[model samples]
Structures are given as C-alpha cells and as structure tokens.
Target chain A: MRRVIKNLISALVALMFVNAAHAAGELHIFNWGDYTNPDLIAKFEQMYDVKVTITDYDSNETALSKVRPGGHGFDIAVPTSSHIPIWIEEGLLMQTNPNEMPNFVHVAEQWRNPDWEPGRNYSVPWTWGSTGISVNTAMYGGEINTSELFFSPPDELHGRINIVPEMNDVMNMAIMYEGGQPCTTDKEVLMRVRDTVMAAKENWKSIDYGTKEKLVSGDVAVSMNWNGYSKRAREENPDIAFGYPKQGYPLWMDNVAVLADAKNVENAKLFQNFLMDPENAAMISAFAQYANGIAGSEAYMPADLASAPEIAIPAELQSAGVFVPPCPPEAQQLYTAIWTEVQK
Target chain B: MAETENTSSVLAAQSHQVAIEASRRNKIRNFRLLSMPALIVLTIGAAGPLLIMLVYSFLKAAPYGGVVWEPSIDGWFGVFLKKDIFDGTISIATAHLSILWRSVNLSIQSTLLALILGFPTAYFIATRSVQTRNLWLFLITIPFWTNLLIRTFAIMQVIRDQGIINNFLIGWGLIESPIEMLYTDFAIMLGMTYVYLPLMVLPLYASIEKLDFRLVEAAYDLYATRLRVLWRIIIPLVRPGIVAGSILVFVPSLGAYVTPRVLGGGKHLMLGNLIELQFGQGRNWPLGAALSIFLLCVVMGALLIYVRVAQRGTTEHV
Candidate 1:
C-alpha cells in the first residue's frame, strides 16, 4: 500500500510538470473587454508561433483586483494609465528593460514617461482618448460643444440626456462646467460640483455605461461618452456626432504592462513590440475606433479616420485637456460621497 | 431444565440489545459521513467569504483599494456621518440614511405592486385544469429563459422615446409628443414588478392550488358576498402564500441593484447598488462590508419577527 501511494504521488508530480511545459508556449492576457483587436492577436499568434489566450475586464477596478495578487498567471494586462502607480505599489507589474523594446521610440513624447510610471519602466501606452459628449445631430439639430448642454439642458432636452457612470468623468465634467479645476482638492469647489451634479440628476435619463447604443438608437439625444465609443456609434448611425466640450474633458490612456508572475515574459515583450509598430498600431486604432499612441501611425490610418474630428484631438482642446490623476484617499472618499448623493 | 431454559433466554435477550446498540451507532456514523462533504463545502464556499468580510469590515480601508490590517470602527461611523476630508472632523449626515430609507420605500412599493399584479394571474392559473395549469405556469416562466439584462434592454426598447409605444401613440394621434416614460420612478417600479412577478405568482399558485374550495363555496352560500368570501376565506386560506411571496419579493427588492440601476438609471440608489459602488468604483471595501452586515442584520431581524408571527398564527389556528 505504501509503494502504491508513493507511485501515485510521483505520477501526479510528473503530470504537473508536463502541464507547465505545455503552457510555456502560450501567452495569457487580461485586457479591457472589446478593447483589443482580435485580428491583431491572431496575427501576433501566427508571427510568434505561440498561442495567445486573452481575457477581458470591463472596469479598471475589476482588472486591478484580478491582477493584485500576482496577476492570476496572466502574462500581460491592460490597465488604465491612472492605475499604473497602484499596480506598481502593489507589486502587481514587472519592470521592463527599455533595451529589449526598440519600438518604444515610436510612442509619442508626452506618453513616454507618464507621471504614473516615472521612468517608463513598467507600462507602454495602448490607446488614449478623451471623455466628451456624443449628440444625435438630427435630434439636437446642432452641435453640442459644452458640458452645459448635458448638466443644465434646455427644457426640451431634459430627460433626454445621460452621463457616463464613471465617477471621475462625471465629477470632472461637473467641475469643468462650474469653471473650476478638474483636479481641485478644495472642499468648497467639490461641494459646488456635487450640488451641480445633484441638480442635473433630475434631468438625466440615466447614469449608465455603454451610452453608444443609447445614442445610436436615439433613446438619448445627448450623452457623456468616450470619443472612441462615439466614433463607433457614428458608423452605425451617421446622425451621431462627438464634440469636445469647450469646458475641457478628461483625457485618459490605457497602458499595457507585463505581470510580475508572467510565465512568458519574452513573448509578452515581443507582442508589445509588435503592437508598437506603426502599421500594426494603426490597424488596432482602426479596429478599436480609438487613436493609438504610436507617433508615425497616422500615415497608415484610413482616410476617414485620419481626418475624423472625433478621433483626432483638435489643437485648441489640447491645452484644455487634463489627465485624470489618482486622488488622495480622503478626496476619493469625498468624491464617492458626492457621487452617492447625486445618485440618491 | 427450567433454569437452563431461563439462562438461554436471558442470553438471547442480551445479544438482541447489543445488536440494536451497534446498529444505532452505525447509522449515526453513516449520517455524519454522508453530511461531511456538504459541511465542508458550506464552510469553504459560503461561511469562509462571510467570515473574511466580517473581519475586513473592522479593518481600515487601504488608501489605494483593499483593506489594511488595522482595526477600526471608522467604517461603521462613516455610514451615518460625513467626514471632513481636510480636517478629519465628522458630522451627522442624512445622505446615507436617506439612501437606505429610499431603498426600503421603493422595495415596499414594488412588493405591493408585484403582489397586486401577481395574485390574479396566479389565481387564474390555479383555477385551470391540471394540463392547462402546467402550460400557463410554463408560459409564466418563459421570461426566465432570457437574461435579466437582455429583458431589461428589451423593455427599454419598448419604452424609449422613439420606441414602439411612443410611435404607436403618435401614429394614432392619441398624443402629439412622446411622454417621457423611461428612467422614471414609474419605470423602476414597473421593471421590478415585471421581474419579481413570477416569484410572487409561483408561491401563490402553489398555495391557492392546495386550498380547499369547499370552504370558499360554503362561505359564498352563507350570504357572504363575493368580495367578502375572498377577503375572509380565500385570503385567510392563502395567508401563507402571501407572506412567503412578500418575503421573497420584498427582501430581494430591498437590495436590488440591476433593476434600479438599469431602469431607474442610477438616480434611484438602492442598498445593493450602494454596496456594489463601495466595492467597485468607491474603492471603500470596509464601508461596503459594514453596510452589507448592517443590511444583513436588518433582514435577519425582520425574518425573525416574521417567523415568530407565523408561529403565533399557526398556534392560534390550531
């Protein structure tokens, strides 16, 4: 009986080793749901002679939770730019050698050394866009160029508008609409924003994600949405239009990083290099309906996308565009409190 | 010969007693063995996370996301008090309290609405023949086949400004303009009623089907009007079903997230959404856990009172 038990244990250990060996040739990725272009993933798989397994998360919080304790064996993950610092502080990401990634030079200058990852050792920019308003031109019969149209609409537009459910975007828009700084930590200013949001709540159709479908279907005449989603919606319904709020919009970036416990770090680096190639980046941009951060990718972009106002940030809005930074703990709590009040 | 016979009989009786004791012990052991798997699963799956949440509720929320090991009651205090971000001073706030109150109020409203809408359908189904009753019940359950999100989305399609309802109303010249129907309190209540109506109907059907029709007939014959017969006889007979259905609908609606979130459009905050927000975007797990515990206690207390009242009712009836 003892001999049989010892043999069983040995056999199980051998099977585990075999399983590990089989997985070595595969790269696992966790990314934002519907954020990646599957064709690019297939192309990468073909070029690398390795299988690529991808998982998607809808929210940065969900992705962070999954990756916090060593990334659940994912080789690479796409987290919002704001979360890179937290990921590093939690030891969830692996440091990358710049020398291994020659394509790093293709990234735009501003995106190279993001404030979150100071030396740019961990993450590379994936896609970037701004949070702004998407309007059905036929319904609104004009351009929506300001947050005022959403927060304090005319009587006709009341109950015909929705805002994104993300706290940062909503609160920032409120702050900008009130002519205050987007990242203001002052209580008085925040309280004012809170009041504005609460007052506007009565006029809102809903505070929800995925406003693209609602806009296309004309369920809502106006919505606060990402530029990419607005662009995607426009393809289905040509009446849909996206505008940069004159009051400024929250600019956001999604970054790709290797996990600390990545089993296929080499493959992950290779994939990142492949994604950074201008043509590949343009392909991703075209597919995702979001602009990539690759500097020379515009030459490869399709004609319609290259000149599309929604995909390209106008020069005037550039100075007004602010990156959403992670707030301090107390400020975060305050934001949540105000958000809860608005929802209530 | 008599003494020998007595000794053999006594020995046989003692042997029989030993046999019974051994079998009883074996049966108990078998029962325990059979229950082991379930006990293990319950401990690991259900009780484990609950214990972790309880522990985390007392800990301080880490600045970034998760909780720190430091013990604190700040989460519990913060539920009803607003903490000043700058000075760290706290004051009584009605925001959270109002949210809780709103949740309770909406849940009660939805529960009553569901009950009103479900009773007639359940009764109609119960009065049907056995073959047809099953067909009706199956029809009632057809909604369950679709995902709740999809069903809610479909409901949105029918109720939106450019939706079928508005189009039909406009085409018929009944209304010149589209009435704002989606994302209102009415829409939330309607959605809740639509989702939980089946929960109410199933139990009511079960109870009404088992009811003795003779008592109802007797009450009717004794000069009891139809309304009086329903109020006194049918209602009393189905009291258990009413209580069961109310509990089933009310408790879930109290903590409902999706219906209110999707239909109410995040304007109508409920306890479940608050809890979810804490763990999701709010990044305040301690507060979320504390709120969860508070909600659980309230539910358990209400259930306890309900059980006691039910027991009293049963005893009085007996």
Candidate 2:
C-alpha cells in the first residue's frame, strides 16, 4: 500500500509539471461570452502551434474589474471604446506598435483615428455594432419606431419588455426618445433623461444584459440588444426583427488589447494579428454575426449576410449614430448615481 | 537549620511541577497557530473580495477604461443624487426593495410550509426502525448532490412554453394559446419555494426526529385539545429547528439570481439582479457596493430584531 501511494504521488507531481508546461504557450483571452466560436480557437491552434484559452465577461465593467489588478492572469482582453482612454491613461494596456502588426492596415477606415484612441496607440478594434430594439412584431402586432417599447411599453407588453441593464444604454435611449442628443453630458439634459427613465422604471419588468437567449425563450416581447445578438436571436426564431429606432442608435466597438504584464506576449500579439487577417476575421464575423473591424473581411463574408439590407452598412445612418467617448469621471459618477437611485 | 533545608527542597519540587504545566499550555497554543490557515482561507475567500469592492467604490472611473486612484465622494453622490429617480415608480430602489420583500416573503412562507409538511413525516420516520429512518434521510439528501443552476433550469424547462406542462395543456385543448407561465411573479415564487423547500425540510426533520413523543401524549392526556397540545408541547420543542430552517431558506434566497432569471422571466427583478446590474452593464461599482452594504445592513439589523423577538416569545411562554 505504501509503495502504491508513493507511485501515485510521483504521478500526480509529474502531471502538474506537464500541465504547467502546456499552459505556457496558451494565451488567456477574456471577452464577451459566445462572441467567438470555439472552432476558431482550434483552427488558430492548428495554424500557429499556440494554444488559446478563452474566458468571457458578459459586460465591459465585469471585464474591467478582472483586468484591473495589473494584468495578473489575462493576456488579452476586449474592452469598449469608452474604456480605452481610461485603460491607456492608467498604463494597464501595452501600446500597440503598428510596425509589429502588419495586418493593422486592414482595419476599417472609420475605426482608425477615432477620438477615443488617437494614432491607434493602445488597442485594436475587433468588432463594432449598434444598440437598438429587437422586437417580435408578432407579439406587438406592429413595428416599433421609438425606444418607447422599452421605456414606456404598453400595458399588455409590461413584464414582456426587456431593457438593457446598463445605465448608458438606458439613459441614452431616454435622451434619444426625448429628442435630445444621446451623448450630451449637459447636466440639465442628463437630469431630464434620468427623470424620464425613473418614471419609466415603475412599469419596467426586467433589465437584461444578454439578449439572444431571453428573446428566443419568449420571456420578452421587445428587448434592447446589439445588432449581432438580435440577428442571432432572429435566426433561431424567424419572427423577430432588429431595428434601429427612428432616433439614432448608440454605436459601440469592442477593442482587443494586450496587457502590460502578459506572459505570452508573442502569442497575444500573434492572436491579435490573426484576428485582423481578412479570411480569419470573416470566419469569426460569419459565425459570431457581429461586424468585424477588418476592412477586407466584408468581401469574404457570405453574400446573404453581407448584402442583407438590415445588416448592410449605410454610410448616412452610420454617421448619424453616436460613437461613445470616455466621459469625465463626474459624468460617470452622475450616471451611476442616477441609475442606482432610479432602480431604488 | 534542618527544617529550612527540607522546606527549600519541597518548594523547588513544587516550582518544577508548575513549569511542566506551563510547558503543556504552550504546546496547546502552538496547536492553535497550526489551525490559523482555516481562518486565513475564510478571510481571503469572503472578506477580501468585499473589501476590494469597497475600495473601488470610492475611486473615479478614469477617461480610459481603468479607475483613477484619486479619492472622491463622486460614487456616493452618484447613488444618492438619484433620489428623484428612486422615488419614481420605475425607480430601481423601489424595484430592488419589492424584489427583496417578495423573496423574503416567499422564503418565509415556504419555510412554514416545509415545517408543516416535514414535521409529521420526520416524526413518523423517527418512530420507525433505525434502518427505515436512515433510508428516509438518504432520500432527502439525493437532490442536493446536483448543481443549483442545472436543477433550477430543469424546473424552468418543465413549465416553460412548449415544455412538458405547456404541451400537456395544449394537447388537452385546455387553452388555445400557451399560457404565459414563465415570466410572471407566480413562477418566481413557485421556483423559490421549490428550491428552498428541501432546505427547510432537512433541518426541520433533524429537529422533529429528536422530539420526545411522550411529552405530547402527556399533554393530550391532560385534556388539552389537538391544537393546544401542538402549540404548547410540540411547537415549542421544534422552535429551534424552525428558526434554523428559516435562516437556511432565507439567507440563500435573499441573494438568489438564477431562479428569478430563468423561471421569473424578466418580470421580477431581485436585489441580486440589481447588484449585478450595478457591477455589470451599469458600470457603477460604487453604487453596486453601496447597494450590497445596504443589503448586509438590513440582514444584520433584521437578525438582531428577530433574536430579541424570539427570546421574548420563548421567555413569556415559560
């Protein structure tokens, strides 16, 4: 028995060393859940001989909290446009050297030189989309043109409507519905928007962060969702429609950044560059259904998904939508305070 | 001179014995030092995360994605400044409170129901052969081996539209349309009750099994009615079990997120969900931490009040 136990202990020690060695080449990526297919990671492993470890955060704030402790565990993370400046100013992200990444040239023109990350310094754009209403017309018996479906849903639709759990989306929707610019940091405008949302909260059933599953489950009639998730949800149940309200939608982007203390720096950079490649980017976009930042990837996308009028990029409509910039701490504080108070 | 030498030798031996006793006490102290790892694990696993959250609440969100180290009242102001919004019908404060109240109310109701159902069942088993009692106890523990989320999701699928219950209703031509059974408050309450019922039963069963039946029979022989005998003899003995069961049911349900998310639909938002939104899409850590502290304060305050009330009630009967 003693000899057997000694053998078992040696085997366990050997196994631990094997796992530690195997984990060395692996890059741990933290991003939105279900944002990419597992097959993409397998394909990347086959091509690059680098293992990929993927973990997902349901929201930007959740991802930020995990990466805040000086990049202890995660090598690559996807954060929103609003968080880029904050992450850069804190030195949490490693500066992206354009020379090192040749595939950076394929990024969409609109993503380059954005006010948030000037000169393409710290982050690389992965995917971009808009926040709009995803409604089941069959349930509503008509079309939804405004954010009212979420803000002031009909009595029958009460408890059936799903709103974004975020204050930015909620407050922005209120501002847009009230004929105010969605991105305005004007105090009076913000207060009015807050009050409007507060009034709407009484009848608000549930605030949902992830939508595709909820919309398909028939728990919600109308939901505020990203264009990609809405499209995905509609594919599962054909009766759903994703539409931007008559008021402009909130345009947001997820950017991939290498952490300052990344263990697998080479693998992390390689992964970012790999994602930038048009063919690989197309495979991701086609499966994820979210629009990618790679310029030439559109050519590689399927004709049905690419040319579909709903998913097509209209230059005029794109310009009208607001790109979220990192606001002052005061504005964020005010937004947070109002959101909590409203929920209370 | 002889007496002095004898006295000194005896004193020396006595002092040596005291030294030996002190050494034994020191060894016990060393044992305590070895057990310190458990306390460190508890502090790191629970209090450490909460303390980090508290610290982050005071900091400002930097223009880039990270938080600025500068201390500010901005986070507190953010939560407090929305008083008008909180006062409004759609306010999160009201919603959070209502959800919490509903969860507490449901948990309490279910606990009472479990006590009623489990007491006699446990008593009968306890009175039976020891082998039968062991089998019954084992059956009660079988469900706990599975994950909570999977079990809750299973319950959801059973009652959901196109689920077994809905299909049965539709097949029987009981209704033209699938009943909106998933998102309503009723479904949330039902799920909470089901999840917590077994928890209440186990504790109650333990208490009921230890009960002395002779005391109840003596009370009945004294011409006490069934209700009076139950209240005076049986209930008083099982009071501790009831309190233990209630705490078990109440604490877990207080912060429950999964059941409401899956079974409650979007209709019923709980305090857990509100706190989640604050950290999640809300991007408001200070407010989320504040809400969490608020919940902790409420739980602590209620516990104090309950202990006092329960003591008084028990003392008065005595």
Candidate 3:
C-alpha cells in the first residue's frame, strides 16, 4: 500500500512539471477592450499549437503605463499612433523585422510608412477610425453635422450634448471648429481654442467616455464619439447617426507592436503576421465594427460593413480627416492644464 | 545586628525587583512576537509604497512617462504655479488650489448629509427586537454587495433625462420637460451619500446598541421633553460614534474618483480626478505623486487632531 501511494505522488509531480513547461509556451496580448475577435485568437492558437492569454485596457494611457515599466510580461500591445513614438523614444518597443513578417505587403500604402514611425520599424497598423459627432436624429429632429452645434447649440439642444473625456481629441475638434491648425502650438491660437471650449462647456450635459450608450439611450442628444462606436450604436438604435463635422475631425489609428521585454517575441511576431492575413483582418474589422488597415481585407468583410461609409470613411470626406500628432511636452502640459480648467 | 538586618532586607527587595523586571520583559517579547506578522505586512504593503511615492514626488517627470531619478522641486512648484516654457517665466495659479478646496468642501457636505440620514436609521434599527434588527442590518448591507461602479451607473439610469424619475414625473403631468438631475452637484452628493451612508450607519449602530436605555427613561421621568431627553442623554453617549462615522465618510469622500467622474459629468474636477489625470493622460507622475502626498498630509493632519481630541475627552471623563 505504501509503494502504491508513493508511485501516485511521483506521477502527480511529474505531470505538474509537464504542464509548467507547456504554460511557458504561452503568448500574452494586451489591447483595447473588446477590440479583437476571439475566433481569430482560437485559430491562431490552433495553427501554432500555443496557448494565448489576453488582457484589455480602456485607454492608451493605461496601456502605456503598464508597458512603460520594463518587464511587464506583455508580449504584444496595441497603442495609438501618437503613443507609438513615445514607446519608441522610451525604448519600450522592439523594432519589427519585416523579413520575418512577409504578410506586411497587404498593409495599406498610407499605413506602410506612417509619419510617426516613418519606416514602420516598430509598429504594425491595426485599426483606423475618425472622431466625430454621433447624433440621435430622432431626439434632435434633424441631422447635426457641424461643429457649431456642439460648441454653441441652439436652445433646444442646450444641455443635451456630451463630449469625449479625452483632452487631445476634444481640443483638436475645438481648434478645427475655429479654423486653426489642429497641431498648432502657438499660445494665441490655443487660447482662442480654449475660450471657445469654455463657452461650449455651458451647454454640455456631460464630458464622459461612454458616449455611444448615452446616445443610444437618448440620455444625450448629441455626443462626440469614435466612428466604430457610433456605428455600433446605430445598429442598436436606428435613430442614432454618425456625422463627420464639415469643419474636420481627428483621425485615430491603433497599431500592434511587440514589447521590448517580451518573453515570447517569436510568438508575438507570428500573431502579428497571422492578424495581417486578409481573412483574419476582415474578421477583426467585422467583430470590432472598425476598419482594418489591410489592403485586401475589405474583400472578405461582410457586404453591409464593406459598404458602410461610417465604418470605411468615404474617399472624398477622407480629406477632412486629420491624423492627430503627438504634442510637444510643453504643449501637452498646457493642454492638460486647460482641460483641468475646463472641468472646473 | 541592626545593620545586618537592614542589609539583608535591601538585598531581598532588590532581587524581587529583578524578578518583576524579567517577567515584564518576557511579556513584551511575547507581545511583539504575536504582532510581528501584521507589522511586517503593514511595512511591505503600506509603508513601502508610501516611501516610494515620497521619493517620486521629489523627482523630475520623465518626458514620456514615469519619473526621473534626479532631484527637482519643479513638481512642487507646478502644483501652485504655471511655467511658460517660451520665456522661462512662472506665474502663480489658483486653479489647482481651488480644486483642492472644492474637494474638501464636497467631502464635508457629504459627510454631514450622511450623518443626518444615517443616525435616525441606525437608531431605529438598534431599538428593534434582535431578529428584526438583524434583518434590517442585512437589508442595509445589501447595496454593498453590488459593485460601486454598477450602483453609480444604476443611479444614472434613474436620474438621467429619459430615466424613470423624469418619465414618471412627465407622465403624471408634474412637469413638461425632464428635470436636469443627473450631472449636477446634487447628483454627486446623492451618489456619495448613498455609497458612504452605510459606513456612517454601522458605527452609529454599534454605539447606539450599547446605550443605557435606563438613562433615557430616567430623563423622561424627570419631566424632560422627548427632544430634550435625546439631546441630553443620547447625543452625549453617541459622540464617539459620530466622530468615528464622520471620519470614515469624510476621508473616502475626499478621495472619491468614480462618483464624481460618472455623476458629476467630469465637470467638477475633484482632487482625486486631477491626480489621476496627472498620471494618465497628463503623463506627469511627479506632479501626481506630489498631489497625492499633499492629500495624504491633509488626511493625516485631520486624523491626528481627532485622536488628540478623543484622548483629551476620555481623560476629562475619567
């Protein structure tokens, strides 16, 4: 009886060792919440015979704070274009080897050499969307297309508008509304933008991040939201509509990059290549309700999404879309200060 | 013979003293041994992070994020001043100071409101029969079982424009349009009061339950009015609970982040929200750490004053 018990204990210990070795082959992914398709993750795991672990963040700042500290154990992260430069400057990101990622050819030409990372050395374009107005036309009784309504709404719409909580996006929209450059660091121009925003603050219902749900529920008549979120909102409520401000709006792009201290660097690269495949990229765009940057991915996307102008910005209106650039440290500080004041 | 007796008595007294001292030392050693685990956990968990935050508050902010190891007082200056990078000039700013004042004002308002609502409820529960008191106490804690975020969101659903309250009012011809109730300061206070009311109630309940009912009856029998009896008898006995409950509610309310962010519409920026922004989008960790330390000092100062007052009160009573 004692020999039997000893053999059982040894077998259990040996099994645990094998499991530990298998767990060592896992991949860790950090991205926006509900941003990727689980089916794609499952397929990738099956294809590579590796286990995948996923974590989600709500904002780019949260992701940056996690990855900025070396050895956060995240093998891959998805950060916005503006944050990519900071990641590179801080040595938090690893340079991509295009030779190993042959599927890079399928990326759109515009994203091939983004101005932020000129040669696409450290980041791969994942998704792109515009920041614009999502209006409940049934509540507003008409299409609310211009930035003027947001900054200075009519009596009926007063105290019925919600703005994004993000400072850069809202400030950029205010600048565009005033016909100034979005990235202008001139104090005089920024002060004018600040005054405009302060004036608009009176009419705002709330400055919150959950604009999509607010619009759908009619808690807010108008909201500044990302294109994809607005698209999803419209699906839930037909009265909800997305409009690109005639005055121009900010364009946001998120990119996937391998962390510098990634334990599973090879697996991270492999997952990136797998995501670049046209069908898989289409699946992501369909699930996320956002446009993927892969060149041929639209061919595999659902017809409704492929035809939806909000999901894919119309070629003509694309000219009005401006890619937000990283601000200088001083300007960033000033923006934060102004945001604090506006909140007050 | 007298000298020898005196010497032996002195010697015996000295040995007895030594034996007592040894036992006292042994008692202290055992006490420390019993508390060692808690002390170590507190040091590692609380004191260690607080020390790190103190160090970071004195350092410079790295451009991308986090802190630089170099010593600098710029973060401290930035808290109360704005620097123009163009000409290297600094100007005094009252914006951050006003936010701090606002947070304290809101915290005090909420704490007082919680006390007003909680005392009566706690007193009523304490006066009930044991079985009923248990049921009422259980009901009071039911809200706590749900996550705070979900509860705040639920509050939004009730107070929003198309929410139940507005709809009911409109349907009953009480109003023509929805009353703006969700994003105002009123809503924030309501949320804070709702969240922290239980904190106030529990302490008050514990104090009220232990009160000598005979004293109240005797005061009433002496021709004291009901209100006078409460004022003279109940209030004096429950002073400690009031102090405890106020501190419990006030401290957390001062550092409230989500309630204000969700219900206040992020319009009224609290100290907690400002500190959070400094770390998140502002990418100014040094400033965030400095603000945090400032808040900590205020709380610690309040706690110390309370402790001293409490000790003095006890000594006077003795």
Candidate 4:
C-alpha cells in the first residue's frame, strides 16, 4: 500500500512536469450558448498547446452587464454588432486591430468596414443571420413575406403563432412595420410600436426562445425566428419554410473581440487571427448554421448552406433587411416600457 | 502581626477576584473567536448581496446596463408609475400592477389547491402503521430526488397539446380537439400546485403524525359529524402546519420563474420574469433592483402577516 501511494504521487508530479513543458497558456472565451464550434477550439488548442474555456450568455445585455464591471477573467467575448459600439465605448474590449492581422484580408469587402466597427480595428465577424418570419405552409398558405402575418395575423394564424421575446429584434420589426427606422426617437412612431405589439400579443401564443423545437413539434404554426434556426426546423418538417419579411427584417451579426483587461492577450490575439482564416470561419458557420463574413469560407462550407434560400438573400428582398443599432438610453427606455406593457 | 496577616488576606482576595474576571473574559473571547466564521458568513455572505441590491435600487441606470453612482428616485417611481412618451402624462403602471396581481392570484390558487389535495394524503400516511408510514414518507419525497426544472418539464409532458393527457382523452373519443392547457392560466396554476405539493405534504405530515386520535374520537362520541370533528378538532390542532405549508408553497410560487416559463409557455410575465426582464433585455439595472427589493418587501410583509395570524390563532386556541 505504501509503495502504491509513493508511485501515485511520483506519477502525478511527472505528469505535472510534462504539462508544464507543453502548455503555452489558457484562453477564456465568453460567447453565446452552443455557438462556439468545438472542432475549431480543439484544433486551436492542438496547434497552440493552450487550454481554452468557453462560457455562455443568452443575450447581448447579459454579456455586457457581466463584462462591464471587469475582473471577469474572460480573454475573448462575442458581442452582437448592435452591442459592439457599446462594448467599445465602455472600454470593455481591446482594440486588437484585426484589420492588420494576416488572415484579415479574407474578410469580405462588405463586412470589412461595418458601421459598428469602422476599419475593423477591434473585432471580426463571428456569425451573421437575419430575423424573419417562419411558417408551416400547410397551416396558412398566404404570402408570408410580411410582418402583417404576426402584427395583424389572420383568423387561422391567431393563437397558433409564437414571437421571439428578444426586445430589440421584436421592437425593431414593429417600429419598422410602422414606417420607423431602427433606434428612431420619434414619439409617434414609438407609440405606434407599442400599440402594434400589444395588438399582436393577443394573437401570439407565446414569446420564447427554442423556436426550432417549437416549430418542429407542431406547437406553433408560425413564428418570428432566426434564419438559421428556421432552416434547421425546415429540415425536420419539410412543410416549414423561411420567409424574409418584405416590410422590414433585422440583419444581425455577432462579432468576436478581445477584452481590454485580458490576461492572455497574446493567446486571444492568436485565437482572433485563427477565426479569420477561411477554414476556421467555415467551421464556425457550419456548426451554428449561420453565415460568416470570410469571402473564401463559403467554398469550404457545406453545399446545402451555400445554396439554401435561408442562407442566400434574393435581390428583391435585399433592400428590406435592415441592421438594428443599439438604441439610445431614452429610446431604449421608451421601448422597454412599451414592451413590458405589451407582455403584461 | 495582625496588620501583616490582614494585608496578605486582602491581596489573596483581590488576586482571586482578578482571576475570576480574567477567566470570564477568556471564555467570551473564545466564544467570539469560535463563532467568527459564522458571523462573517451571515453578515457578508447573506446580507451583503441584499445590501448591494438596496444600494443599486437608488442609483441611476447606465446608458446600456450597469448603474451610475448618482443617486435618484426614478427607479422607485418607475416601479409604480409610467410617463407617456408623447403626452407626458404620468399614470399608474398598470402593467406592473397587473403582473403583480397575476403572480399573487396564481400563488393563492396554488396554495389553496395544494391544501385541498395534500391534507388527505398526509392524513392517510400519518394514520398508517409505523413501518408503512415511514415507507409512505419516503415515497412522498421521491419527486424531490429529481430537479425542480425536471419536475416541471415532466408536468409539461403530461399536459402539452400532443402530450399524454391530451392523447389519452382524444384516443378515448371523449374530445374532438385537445383542450388548450399549455400557455394558459390553467397550465401555470397546475404546474405550481404539482411542483409545490410535496412541500405542502411534508409539513402537514410532521404535524399530523403527532396528532392524538382521542380528541377526534371523543368529538365523534358526542354526536359530532365527521366534517365537524375534522374542522373543530383536527384543523385547530394542525394550524401551525397549515400556516407553514402555505408559506412554503406560496412564497416560492409568487416568485416562480421556471414553471411559468416551461408550462405557462412564457406567454405573460410573472413577477420574477418581469424583474429579470428589467435586468436583461430592458437594460435598466436600477429598475430591476427596485423591483427585486419591492418583491422582497412583499414577501416580508406576507410573512409578518402570517406570523401575527399564527400567533393570534395559538392565543385563541389556548
């Protein structure tokens, strides 16, 4: 027994020495739940000999609030495009200047100088998708390319529809449907936004996440959903289809950046540069079923993702997809009040 | 010689008094040292977060999410009032009021229903033989072995549109369409009642097990009906248990977040969800903090009322 204990302690010390020799460092990533591609992380870990830890946040606000106070110990964070400016303005994110990175040239020209990150200094695209209407054609065979299907649903659609409970996404669509812009501070538009959603809530059965499961389970015939989730749902139930709201829809993109107070700044920089590579970017898209901004990454993506209507935007509806920026404090307050009333 | 002897005796007496005082002080010091960790845990670990919440409720909300150090009453005002965006008319926050009403209403309903369902089960178990009573109690706690969230999901599986109850009813040709249970008020109430039923049972069992059957039999011998005996004798004896069980069920039900989210289908906001909304997507930390403090006050108020009523009941019974 004594010999066994002695051998065990010796073996543990030897293992620690081996680990000390090979290990480079550790990288902590805070991203959306189930959004990180495991394969990409595994590959990065093998190449760099660094351990990576991933944490999840359900919404941009959650991530922001958690990271804003500092001492979070997260090396990297993924913030949506709308929230990127807030993170930057708050000095929560480091200006890593990914535009100067070696693989940055592969970033698509359209995404190269996004409004959120001019010159792409601080962040790189993680995933980009649109929020639009999804419907099971077998339930309602009407034109689904309009927000009217939700805001003023027909008799057949009433009590059979689900609404995604995201405040910004829902409010942006409602405001746009009432002929307002994203983050508009016009009082009249804001009031209409309130009334529109309140009336629509009467028709909506639930406001929730887990759209794909609800859509596949025949729980809701129609829902306002993310395009990637709608695509996944369509695969399960062929009757289900994605509809780009011609009235207005949100084009959302999540971007990855290093924290200003990151302990492992070098490792974080390496991870960010790694994400810009075509193969790595493609892996991210393939896992999350979303699009990446790397131009050559599509060639590496699955053929189905490349050809699907959900992935590719038609020319006519292209003008309708609008990017919602983070609202100012006053407008956000107004929107929150309206949303709370609607839910109540 | 007498003077010397008196001095020695005096010194001995003073020293002995000093030793007694020193020993007493040592004992108190040891007690403080031994209990230092618990005191720190209670004050800092438990009350520290609550103190932070109380402070945050008075601060200004940052542009995005965090709080600013500047103190303001706007957060408290936002809890009960809303200003119109265009008209500038200040009105009662009907939305907050209604959500508050729904939470209380559902909690009351669940408590009442649990009492109705649990009293008999507890009585049946309490009356069983000692071995069987132990077995019954073990079975009563079986649901607790699983997670609260899992138990809620289990209830959802039983009542969903395509779930067991609906399918069973339809298969028997008793219904043409599945009765819409999920996402309705009924679904939330059912979830709360079922999830908290065990809490109700355990307390009632603890009280009923100690109940003497002689009084009940004596009441019956005097020509009292079964209902009268139960009401006049059994209920009074177990008043503390009922109060305890109701508090255990009602408090958690009022703050219920998961059951409503899972079974209630997230159609509406409960008090808990509304507070979460202000913190999360609403991006109003002060408001969320204010709401949470408000909820804590409401629960404290309810507990105080229960304590008073229970005290009154005990006094009246005596």
Task: Report clash pairs, candidate 3.
Answer: none
TM-scores of the models, in the order given: 0.90, 0.82, 0.92, 0.93
What class would a CAPRI assessor give candidate 3's docking?
medium
DockQ each candidate and list the results: 0.51, 0.29, 0.59, 0.73
lDDT of 3 at B27: 92
Tens-place lDDT per residue, model 3, B103-175, is 8888889999999999999999999999999999999999999999999999988898889999999999999
Better of 3 and 4 by DockQ: 4
Clashing pairs in 4: none
User: By lDDT, is 1 or 2 better?
Assistant: 1
Ranking by DockQ: 4, 3, 1, 2
lDDT of 3 by residue, A163-264 (tens): 988888888888888888876777777778888889889999898888878888888889998888988998999888888887889987899899999989
Model 3 reproduces a share of the real contacts of 0.68
Best prediction by DockQ: 4
lDDT of 1 by residue, B1-318 (tens): 999899999989989989999999999999999999999999999889889888889999988778999999878887778776546677775778888887777778888998999899999999999999999999999999999888887887788788889999999999999987877778877787788889999999999999999999898789999999888788778888988998998888878888888877777677888998898889998999989888888787877897688668766655
Candidate 2 per-residue C-alpha lDDT over B1-318 given as tens digits, one digit per residue, 9 for 90 to 100: 999899998888888988988998998988888878988998999899888777877887544334578886656554433344223333334545565677667556655666666677666766778888889888877878888888887787877766888889989999887776766666766777677777777777788788898988899889999999878887788777777777777766777788877676544566777777666655556666766766777677767887678778778777
